[model samples]
Target: MAVSNQEQTPVEAEERGARARTARLMLDTAVQLMQGGIVPSVSDVAEAAGVSRATAYRYFPSQAALVQAVVDEALGPILDWKSASVEATERVGDLLSSSLPRIDAFEATFRAALKLSLDQWAQRQAGTQGSEPQFTRGHRIDLLRDAVAPLRGRIPEAGLDRLGKALSLLFGIEALIVIKDIWGGSAEEAREVVLWAANALMAAAEAEADKS
Candidate 1:
């Protein structure tokens, strides 16, 4: 019998649903393990998810692939975040106020991703990293640009770029770790620190634009 090309048979539909469930299980397991602050291999996630190595490997081809899925999970709402306020400073503040908490909540997972990226960097430097997919970072750049987007006409392009760079240092897990672990501040304090600095940078950029 010639099967319809567009429609899945009952068996095919069941297999697709089963595959999706298995992928979700492995990804959930990966996120749970990453919460403890270490990036787990595909095999590790498979074991923890009660899945066999072959099945896990079939779902996720490598450690990088697993981490990528978990990173997307960790990023979730933060990636789609946008500010309703029209004010540049207010937008920046809104972005920080909303995102910092999420970053802190997923601090362990972000740190794990950072560590893996650093490892890949070191391996590449030593000419030892072979055939491994590099873990990607730098979501902050676009987010910052979007946050300060209201200043495009008011500030020079370079000033806006500089502001984004300065803000990046005070954002994300790096900033959270500094404010929480090093400065020993509370989450509220971390938010305060980022807001103050972000506001100050916004002011400085506008001030520079005035001079321009």
Candidate 2:
């Protein structure tokens, strides 16, 4: 039984890859559970992943960590869309159109994440660091900027703030909740409504710029 450092390197790499794969699998399961209305707990996820509870805890030390991981895992495509739209479009309308479809695909996850947003805001207002989603407002603002870049010339500098507010109000989780929970739209319909509203806002901004 001889163990050499040289021979251990490949084995270590394999172990690392396996751990990464396992972590990813656990995250995937958590997302699916969330989508399925399961409200997945660490123990539930560990059971689903066939890992020990301690192993799950090692990867995600808290419920917030697990929830954030699910949110991040689901946003991969949205990030890609932002990157692509940032590169391809020269007009705001086109960029909005490009981004909306990606946003549509991930609307449910966004809605789920938004469920606690207002409570978090209230806590922050009260001077407590509340449990917020993994993503930050700055990240969302960056995404908004990316979606608006194509309209830079057409949307006046002064109007950018208004446009940002309009888009943020119309396209986010609260909007989804209003559509689904308050307004009684299905998830699919709510996404379509948000996309339509986003497109309309972009088009209106363009038209106003053209008039001026």
**Top candidate (TM-score):** 1
Which candidate number has the best lDDT?
1
User: Which regions in candidate 2 have their CA more than 4 angstroms from the true location?
Assistant: 1-8, 82-108, 118-139, 153-158, 186-192, 207-212
TM-score of each: 0.91, 0.68
Q: Write the per-residue lDDT of candidate 1 for residues 12-110, one digit (tens) a residue.
A: 999999999998999898999999987899889888999999999998898888898898898888889888878888888888888887888888999
Clashes of 1: 0
**What is the C-alpha local distance difference test score of candidate 1?**
0.87
In angstroms, the error of model 2 at 31 is 1.2
Per-residue CA lDDT of candidate 2, range 115-191, in tens?
54444567678878545443333345666777677667766777876887787776445665688778888766766
Model 1, position 126: C-alpha lDDT score: 100
Cα RMSD, each candidate: 1.9, 4.8
What would the TM-score be for candidate 2 when compared with the true structure?
Answer: 0.68
Cα error, candidate 1, residue 68 (Å):
2.0
Q: Model 1, stretches more than 4 Å misplaced? A: 1-6
